[model samples]
Target chain A: MHLMDTEPLTKLDPSYSTVMRIEGVLALIPLLIAGIALYVAAEVPAWVPGIALAIAALVLVFYLPMKRYRSRGYHISDDRLRVVKGVMFHADTVVPFSRVQHLDVEQNPLERMFGIARLILHTAGTHNASVTLPGLAHDNAITMREAIRAHVKRESL
Target chain B: MHEWLRVNPLSMAVQMLRTLGSAIVPAAFVIFGAGTQDSEKFAEIAPWIIPVLVVIIGVNLLGAWLGWVRLRYRVGEADVRVEQGILSRQARSVPYERIQDVSLEQKLIPRLLGLVEVKFETGAGGKEELKLSYVSEAEGEKLRETVRALVEGETAAPAVAAAGEAGEPAAEPTGETLFAMDTRRLFVFGLFNFSLVVFAVLIGALQQFEFLLPFDLWDYLADLFRQDTIAQAGDALAGYTLVAQIAAIAYAVVAVVVVGMASGVVRTFVQDWQFRLDRTAKGFRRRRGLLTRTDVVMPVHRVQALVLKTGIIRRRFGWYGLSFISLAQDAGSANHDVAPFAKMEEIAPIAREAGFTLPGESADWHRASADYYFDRAVLQALVPGAAAMAAIVLGYTLVGLLLAALAGVLVVGEYFLWRFVRHALDPQQVMSRVGWLAPRWQIANRVKLHSVEIAQGPLARRRGYCTLRFGLAGGRLSFRGLSLDDARAMRAAVLDSIAAVDFAHLPR
Candidate 1:
């Protein structure tokens, strides 16, 4: 059976867009301050700050979130879990259940506010030991963690 | 099992001395600078120095005493627990099964005191899992044996414990000498591992203090080169300043190289003096080092993979070094070097004694497809070549041309190196051999592989090729530029081997 051709992998929660937007605004705050400071210090035309603000909004609020969201996906096979991410630089990581050392479910304040969480899988080797799939729904994270733990137990046995 | 035991109280003195030793360098520098000012200034500082030293010693001793009082450890049947930290009260419990290596170390003071420091290395890579410092040598050995027995018991069937209780003859400790390095071999190792960077740095540091020297060596050299001095020496080279300068520089370079080689020799001797690898029924016991002796016990199953490494110089002499990729990061360091330098013929036998075998011995070796040259070309050549062109367009013409030339040279080098990149699969082992400059061959047991990944980048996907990677317990290795079909087949074969091994390990 073709592995990649099977059922489509699950995507992150839709509310992740709102979370990204909030993150974008928070990130853009410093850039916005820097732009205003430069315009005031250098005494450039008023339109330069306006243009900078427009480009920042286009990048942080719209383009980046959409592309990043589109690129992120994860799937679970019988023995392994695969997380595929990155747009220009694509990475597909497949970790077997037997290799998993532990599983962690985390929800930062921002993620908790958005009703979403992240699932992290720690494996044996140092390189690529921690595979994280973020923007998972809170319930989905719990269930997936349980499923993975059970899979590891069965595999080891 | 929960009862906490503290190390010998004398450990506090060792801890305090260690703390003071670390601070002594800075304190000495301060005193030295003060002494250079004037006798009055030195005396002014000297009076306060004693009190300051006393206070520092007192504080360190107090801290060590408090730390010793707070720190406690216990060995449970299944796990080892440590409770430390005077203020925060930190506790850690490491499972016996996860203990990959148990190492015993003895420094000069500790050895004189007949005490040993035992370190437990669990595969987890944060801080060290646990350390029992300044325990009696006998106590340390007992703790090591108990942990090893517990870990072995977990694997070989709990019946091993019952057999022990029934006095089924305590496990035989007939350890064989797998390998040992004598003074001659160590000297050869030192000669081959000669490095000049340390000497160069030292010379540079000395040059920084040239102003502080009582008499200028350069001035002495200039005086020797004076016309009167030359004439007194029979006027053989009265006006040959060019020759004299060249000779002086050449002598300096030779001096540096000689010093560098001597330093390398000293370092190698100190590190690997009387290095020995012993194979006990429990696992491999390695003991080495001249000044600070280290003894480590690495269970056979804990070794993830075996790596045969040879440098360009060592390759000419047919000498290769061997090390194990173990679950513990400590085992990956220089201390785990099983063979400092061994002949090509010696590798297979030595590796066989370990869990894995040397590549091409029991397997049908298949050289990676010629397309691998293209993969290396893209990585080592095309990308850099493109960067060169970009640099040229961006007005860095000279740098771009140099980079372009370097890219060309590497591509040709990798073209020659490509033939060495071969992979083979036996019934139970997977081996990959690669490299030409410092030819390295890695053999990993199929059963130890945690995951197999087949990755195809954008370029490889278009080229119908992929890179296959095998992730073992401590490290991972990959073979690039396999056709998609071959990659898939290898992945399936590896997965099948893993399954078969897992099934074999299952209870009948």
Candidate 2:
């Protein structure tokens, strides 16, 4: 089987990593509080919060979001849409336009502020039934959704 | 009917009965416990218990009543709409074209009341898309007919309906009988599908609830083998070391097999009593039951693939089970069994009827390389071997050794089984055959192909191989350890077929 590799993948909006980093930091807030409480109670060493901050700064602020953003990509062709993501375990799914049951573009508060939205593609099978591509420019998400909807309608005929 | 309708008033009674049935056991247990403790104390609490029971039943009945009152459904021109939920109203509209199946179920009470539960199945698995419980039988049938008509109209064009692919005049031939099983076949099928798991569960339940049983079953079983007999056997085996251990294991094996086969036969017979399949106007219809009859209609076009399975013992008898990987959800069942157990010859006609040929014993089957075989063997053994080593280090020497031995056996067994795991692609179909204990042949029509995927992990990339996965409407098939080039080619072929969706074989 020779797969045609002419189509190049379009990378997600660069600001996606910034959104991921901000979300990650928000998640680490509780951990930071716990570390501070332990130190204030004189139970944990002063280095505890220091270590926590360093680890959070390294992972949440840098490594994870950057690595994830770099790994995520998608390609939309005339007949199908391909989404590739996964840092450790890579998955490249190609959903044929005819098979798409529905498509949706959603924006959470954070994503709305970031000017990005998520595009979801629902297919027939239970396994990998829906593929979500996050961190697309809001306008791009709408365009992609419309393009997919139009393709689905034409192919369904 | 254009107007929105509620289920029959009998539904409230049905719901109440269901609630009562579940509450009966717990209520009885409480009363029994109190009585057993002290008759005088039980008498004092008995009066209070009556009111408590009444309140419990009242609350359940009220909930059911509210649910029934709130739930309303309408049969639209091309869609079925439902408005339900008391507190948070939910409205669902399902297009007739998306309805994969229509099943009519009847329990004793509902059947007696001339009521049926109609369930609409969409390919998406989880809950039934629509359920109308305790609807009048006639109304249920009418609704089913309407949905089925819409599905047929969408698929069957004027020209195609004139003469079906089978060359049958498509005026609906009074429902052609496809397969039916007799009592003898049912008994044999039960025997072949013998489940040791059920026997184990039975023994486990007996052990756990030994006190609950009226008679002391354990004591009775012990009485079957006298103390003297056991002592005598032990003495006789003392001369040969480990002989008694082997004898005990052999005895247990024989007992389990005997019980397993008996229970298996009973289970199969009860489940599939009077099993029958017939080709209906819109699709294949199946009706069977011992206690609660189920009528499941699987629309032809909705079937994603066909699966043929045969256990080691069943294979010896040249018998195989047939099931459809369809969008149709069979209420409580996973795979809708078309034929429980049939000889290869018997299954061929049914296969052809479904627009496919039976898996031939001799075929041009393609297999992965020897490296692929070795790769599986290594992967299967690696984790277990490592676990065994860790266990040995943690002072579980004997168990660790046993685990290591089991892992070795598995790797060797897999090496042999790998030879049978192969796939073949014909013009119209792609077949994947796999298994050691139970060989399963999954065949998908090219037209049903929904999508194609190629995944390569770091390990697979290093090995110069990748996995090719093909998606159908309700199922996914994966071919592992294929060379990168072959995986790409297969993916391309599958995608091409999906793009070139054949209109001639559209689901009808």
Clashing pairs in 1: none
- Quality of candidate 1 docking, DockQ: 0.29
lDDT of each: 0.77, 0.78
The runs of at least 3 residues in candidate 1 whose Cα sits more than 4 Å from the true structure, single-residue gaps closed, are A1-75, A104-119, A134-144, A154-157, B1-101, B126-128, B150-159, B162-174, B200-254, B361-408, B454-468, B480-486, B498-508
Categorize the docking of model 2. acceptable
TM-score of 1: 0.77
At residue B144, what lDDT does model 2 achieve? 77
Among all candidates shown, the one with the greatest TM-score: 2
lDDT of 1: 0.77
Q: What is the DockQ of each candidate?
A: 0.29, 0.40
lDDT of 1 by residue, B445-488 (tens): 87677666667777776667778877766677888777767766
lDDT of 2 by residue, B91-191 (tens): 98888767766779888778878899998886555674678887999888877776765655665456345545657542345587889889999888888
TM-score of each: 0.77, 0.78
Task: List the pairs of residues colliding in candidate 2.
Answer: A1-B488, A1-B489, A2-B489, B301-B507
